[model samples]
Target chain A: MSIIKAVHLRKRFIVKKKEPGLKGALKGIFAPKKIIINALDDVSFSMKKGEIIGLIGPNGAGKSTTIKILTGILQPLSGEVEVMGLNPQKKRAEVVSRIGVVFGQRSQLYWDIRLGESFELFRRIYRIPDEEYNANLELMDSLLGIRRLIDIPVRQLSLGQRMRGEIVSAVLHSPDILFLDEPTIGLDIQAKRNIRKFIREINQKKKTTIILTTHDLGDVQELCPRLVVINKGKIIEDGALDAIVHRLAPERILQIDTDKVKKDFTYPHCKMIKCEENKMWISFNRENVSASKLIAALSAEVRINDLQVKEPDIEDAIEQIYGEG
Target chain B: MRCAVQSWFEYPLEMLCWIIFIPLYSFGGLLLLKVISTQFSEIGGWTFHGLAFFYGLGIVTHGLHVIFFFAVWHTNYMVLNGEFDRILLYPMNPFFMFIIQSFNIAGYIDITPGIIIFTYACLKLNLDWNAVAILKLIAVLIGGTLIRTGIFMIAGAIGFFRDTRNAVTNFMVDFLAYNTTAFPLNIYPYGIQVILTFLIPVGFINTYPAQDFMGMDNTFSIPINLSLCTLLVGIAFFLLAYGFFRFGLKHYKSTGS
Candidate 1:
């Protein structure tokens, strides 16, 4: 089922422009220039239940704005958004109650209080029943090993621990949909692995639908099967991760280290992009030339010492989209 | 509210300092009133005890306002920092959540000296303490707090449209609330008195209610029970301010992260 839908979402902000120097400051006090920023323009997408979709984009590409609109923290100038068959803007309280959100740059937990205390406060705010709250807390503790960090003040906890606490706080009420905005923006590898495991566990155990917006391609590669690539306030590409990679970045790099230089060496279905001394870099479409075939051709021309095949990743695919945009 | 109090208590030294300093601050104000009383037997037709009563009443209302509605003062900061976005994301009523999240236990320190001064003034005046009178005092405190909070809320709501950085709220608290409500309104010219009573309504917070308590005749020519008007005006003004705040919410352009 389509659990979330947005149609032609448009949002704009009026920003004040102040010129440089003292005279400009004085003039700004009198009459400042105003500029309009179209934060989101004609952005539309839909998500099905129990699916993990990555919303990836460059900085200031309206990723956060789209998440805010979906969560009803923002109102679009023109659009229709429906979450769980209800208009999010009109039924904000109801919609918010059914959805959980985590903004990695911002925190919902009280900084001066214990992590457990903050969770208790959220429990009261979300009105979660004591039984369900306890159950969820236990599940989170088991999955993330958060029991040790619960007594520490949020300000005192390490970023990774605090982020685990944040995720637990968000899901204490058992929301059906979860929005994670840059959830792994700053974390060590172990911490990031723990969070990803927890997220996968939650989705598998509860079938929670998740919308993840992030710049971390590793996060997208591991967690999201579907991807929505946005740039300059527009949805440029949306499909399965494999499909996007195939369409945008189908070329693989072949690095070959040869014993001797071959000035006139050439091959079909591949181009040598770089050559220096006895080393060469070849670019080839994966569909047109297999790594073995290219290796065979290079060996026939020159004695090969070492060779390596580099596959294109999600980063390359997203860069391809951003470059076109 | 529990979390707010818990966090406040976490700072032992700061909490101790605030506890000690609040009563000392109230005592300093009382000393000023004492000096003024010694200089003039009656200023603006009110004796030293009547003035003490008025001052104590104002302090109590101020304490309550600080305790319950102090978060309104930070609306500008919250809007600028995008912290207001989290408040909106909550399922609860954002205004109620904002107020509750900032429930300050330090305000109880302010109330301690206020109650002592109010009790001292009552004893000096030989005022009859009845159930109705006690209820009236509670009602007056609530009304006065609502008035103070409503005015500040209006000022705070302006943050949604412009980045005032709380200049307007500071002005209102300093000039309208402190300068006027802390003294007998009758000391001002008749025009200023009318403005305080009807236009800005700071007079209704303390001066008008104190007039009713002291059984003094209404200074203004307007035909209205000034005491009864306090609660009504407070409710009406608070509702209007909340409506304005809601209007601002509709136009809230949340700051970028």
Candidate 2:
């Protein structure tokens, strides 16, 4: 059974039509106009109990809107949404207790208080049992090293540290599902790796269903097994990571670095894409041309010093999907 | 609340200014009172000490409103800045969270002075201190604070519908209610007194209850008992304000990512 479901969700916003210049501003105050913006149009998707689905989209693609509706922070103009067998709209408080949400662009921590104090506040708000709260704290400490930073006030922490603190506060209640919106944004390599590891550990240990929305392809590549690509308030494609990648960009690239000048060589199964003084690039469909067989054919013609095989990455596949739309 | 207090105290200069200004402002009110009483024993059939009691109620509740409902005043800013989105995601009641988050201790500076002045007024006036009087005082304080909170909430909720900030919030809370509540309501014309008594109900803060306690004539001929009417008006306005807030949340379109 799906843990989270959104079907035919539609939402529209009435934005004021602001005119330009001082005269226009005065005119707006006297007689303003408004236009309707379709924030989400026929957006639909479903996720299983323990799957981590990366929801990727271009800016203004309704990615955040979908998360907002599913999390009950927003009410769709028309749709059906269920999180953990409860309609989020009607049962917001109950459903929210069963889920955790983190927005990387916004921190939920209390700015004036220490990290530990924020957690304690959440503890009382959620009314989490003592054992469960402490255990979750220990788990978060192991995964994100939350203990060392507990004494520090939120405003004093760096962006990376604050993001980690945000994640800890979100999950301290052991929510069955977690929604992370760009959780690894604006982080260094080490911080990103640590966050990714923490997410993976949580999912594995507790079977937590995670729906991550991110523009950073690295986050998608590292954490999400399933991909739900959205564009212009529509779901373009949804499936396993490799399946989407293969369907969008079927060909892989093979580069050969030889000792001396190399003549452009082509195999019947593979197409030669580029040739330099000592390197040659070939593109071939993985389904038809086995890497071993292609390498054997290339070696017969030239002395290869080094070879590298490159599979199509999530970024290229997502870009191609977005481009098509 | 503790955290908010600590953050304010972080700047010594600001704290010093607050400490000094609180008393200075109270003394200004006393000076006005002294000037008026020196010329005449009473302005509107009320002694200086009696008028001070009314002034104390308004000032103390204003201080409480600032301490407890500060978030309501800033709700517009939060909505415009998208900080309110944080409040909506929490599992608990968002209104409760907003109230708790707004608890500020700096208001204690203003409240402390009001309490000191109120005690002095009661002693100087030799007012009755029976259980009934104590009960009436508690009821008025709660009702008055609720009225202030309702007005502030209504003001802040306007931001949820429009992108612009309105000046009515400042006019109502700062000038309209604050200035009117400190003086005897009877000093104004009958029409104005009626509006304050029945329509906006700012009179419930100190005017009607103070009149009832001091055995004076109330401005409005309320159908129900004065004490009950005061409490009910406070509650009714508060609930209406909360309902308006819920309505506003339905249209709360959070700003940029």
Candidate 2 CAPRI category: medium
Runs in model 2 lying further than 4 Å from the true structure: A256-308, B5-12, B37-41, B166-168
Candidate 2, B1-257: lDDT as tens digits? 66667667667798889999987888688779878987897888888888888788778777777788777877777788887677887777888877778687778887887887788888887888999888878777788888888888888888888775545566666666678876878889999998887778888888777777777777666656566667788999999999999899878888646
Best candidate according to DockQ? 1
Candidate 1 per-residue lDDT over residues A214-274, each given as its tens digit: 8889888999999998988999989999999988999999888887867667778788888
Considering only the true interface residues, what is the Cα RMSD of candidate 1 after superposition?
1.0
**How far off is each candidate at the interface, as Cα RMSD in Å?**
1.0, 1.6
Q: Chain B, candidate 2: TM?
A: 0.93
lDDT score for residue B110 of model 2: 79
Model 1 regions more than 4 Å off: A287-297
Clashes of 2: 0
TM-score of chain A of 1: 0.96
